[model samples]
Target: MLLERDNRLEQPDSFYAGLIAAHDGLSLEQSADLNFRLLLILANQIGRHDVLQAAIAAAREGVTA
Candidate 1:
């Protein structure tokens, strides 16, 4: 289970980096839509709504920190 968890978490940073890069070309509405879709994908893969929420909240906090 732990191995599965670790492997699941081990997806390439470049994947998200690519998403961020792609986001740069988007209009505000398009960017918001893309981010929502990406969050849904991530939440499904990670399998925990609270974990997803916490991660997102933490990331937001980090950005402002």
Candidate 2:
């Protein structure tokens, strides 16, 4: 399976808003932790190693340290 690159969310704006809202009142550390936990949960749900690797590579495509 391939990592989906297209917008598949039914309510993309709403999902984005909700994701941002989830960090409300969180400290920097807490927000980072929340994001990691969410990523783990979602990755587990999509349990294919190759797909996850593709997603990781895609996410890092234009990112710099």
Distance from true location, Cα of 58 in model 1, Å: 3.7
Best-matching candidate per TM-score:
2
Candidate 2's C-alpha runs over 4 A off are none
Measured by lDDT, the strongest candidate is: 2
Structure candidate 1, residue pairs in collision: none
Query: Candidate 1, residue 63: CA error in Å?
Result: 8.9
Candidate 2 residue lDDT tens string, 1-65: 48666788999999999999999999999999999999999999999999999999988997988
Let me know the TM-score candidate 2 reaches against the reference structure.
0.86
Off by over 4 Å in 1: 1-13, 56-65
lDDT of each: 0.73, 0.93
lDDT of each residue in 1-65, candidate 1, tens digit only: 21233444345797778767988878999999998897788679888767767777766986855
